[model samples]
Target: MTNLNASHASHRNFILTGIPGTPDKNPWLAFPLGFLYTLTLLGIGTILAVIKVEPSLHEPMYYFLSILALTDVSLSMSTLPSMLSIYWFNAPEIAFDACIMQMFFIHVFGIVESGVLVSMAFDRFVAIRNPLHYVSILNHDVIRKIGIAILTRAVCVVFPVPFLIKCLPFCHSNVLSHSYCLHQNMMRLACASTRVNSLYGLIVVIFTLGLDVLLTLLSYVLTLKTVLGIVSRGERLKTLSTCLSHMSAVLLFYVPFMGASMIHRFWEHLSPVVNMVMADIYLLLLPVLNSIVYSVKTKQI
Candidate 1:
């Protein structure tokens, strides 16, 4: 164990935990993790390829779905190296700089995922509420603009988190609570006052995930209202069916995410392994599930 307290923050290495209660089982755990990771990549790759190769699928809704798939793959890749190292080789040490960088990319992709989901919700709203002008309203130019805006917002919101974590001095054990680097986990290990970091983290979450969820809900509310106005019962059911996949994706993401956040805040007394599992489900399982959900629900995919 390196003495992190005696050394400068830059010189210290953080220990990444694989699983809290079962270090001996990490090697065995690698098999399932690797299988799921392979499934995730294959699933997302198929989606992107299908969307690109098919001329009929070049609509705004599929465009947003492509963005969501890209975000999921990026987020998964950001954490894959460290996770593989920990579970496969019993190698858990990560340099401070690498950890910070990992944390940055993870957060950036996460925010982008949220934004993409919101965009998908908006796509559903437009398509359901006004079917005739959906094409004109969400033309290619508009879709490109939405993509750029989502990326820009994600970068701006997460740009400060690395610097914020960098400025804090770490004078305690550097073992993180999860397999991957996260802003919340990293900030907790800092010895200095984390009031600013904590507050900023809260604000970022509220603005990104919280706002995204609210907008998604609002879009669905309006969508449901529109569905009710249609006279034909079959038409109403047909219209609602289109939203099922997006709704599933949203719940898959926000539910585990909110559960993990709540666990961090209110369930500290629970075993650290529980926290690790929740975080894993949010980061790893959600992507695979998203790919699966869209594939099963969307006939085009």
Candidate 2:
């Protein structure tokens, strides 16, 4: 009876304590992930190459577009390599420090991207509403200042997230459920109370992601109002078309993001695989689609 009780206790412990296994052991999962990563890299690379070769594309919009492409490439590079290795090479282990670093840069590029998108929307608004002042308002000096401000803002905002994570006392459970070390998953492993960490995460989300979306929406609203006041129906339609493309990209990115957040926070029964895939759609797929929409619709590429 004593031996049987001990065995039961061991099995219960195994069941209660989540342990990560080889993610790539499932071939069905590996192939789709591999293909998506390849597509993301290739799409961003081609955009950057075209921007470099076309001298006419050196204006503020394409300049920012080039920066956007580079950010997407960097963002994918940060997460995809490790994800691919885990799924294809059967490597499931990541050191705790490396995990923190990954989470840091992931948010870093994410914040920068958000800031860049807001800047892009503002650029479009000015171009459409005040074409005469467009060149003067968004001159080379102003673009340089905007770039500097974006980098500074991103650094200031995201610097504390990784530091906060690093200070937390992680217990023995180093295995993250998702493909990467998401902030919430890392916090869950902490033996210490994580109220502060959770609050900080929420703050970052509200200020960076929430604020960016709000500002972008506001810019489009004002742009649309101004465009409607124009006398020419054809001109108004053209402006609406451009704004619609941007709005479509924004909705594609944000809807999935909010959905994933809700599922991860409220719905525990949903599979971690589904959550990670949704995150991939929000982070990687949206940016790739943004490049495509802007390129084809605006005829800038």
**Candidate 1, lDDT over the whole model:** 0.91
Error of 1 at 240 (Å): 0.2
lDDT of 1 at 169: 86
**How close is every model to the real structure, measured as TM-score?**
0.96, 0.86
Let me know the TM-score candidate 2 reaches against the reference structure: 0.86
Which candidate number would show the highest lDDT if scored against the true structure? 1
lDDT string for model 1 (142-234, tens) is: 999999999999999999999998898887678888888999999888878999999999999998899998999999999999999999999
Residue 271, candidate 2: C-alpha displacement in angstroms: 2.9
- Candidate 2 accuracy as lDDT: 0.73
How big is the positional error of residue 3 in model 1, measured in Å on the Cα after superposition?
Answer: 11
lDDT of 2 by residue, 188-250 (tens): 777678898888888888988899999998998898889989999998887777666566666
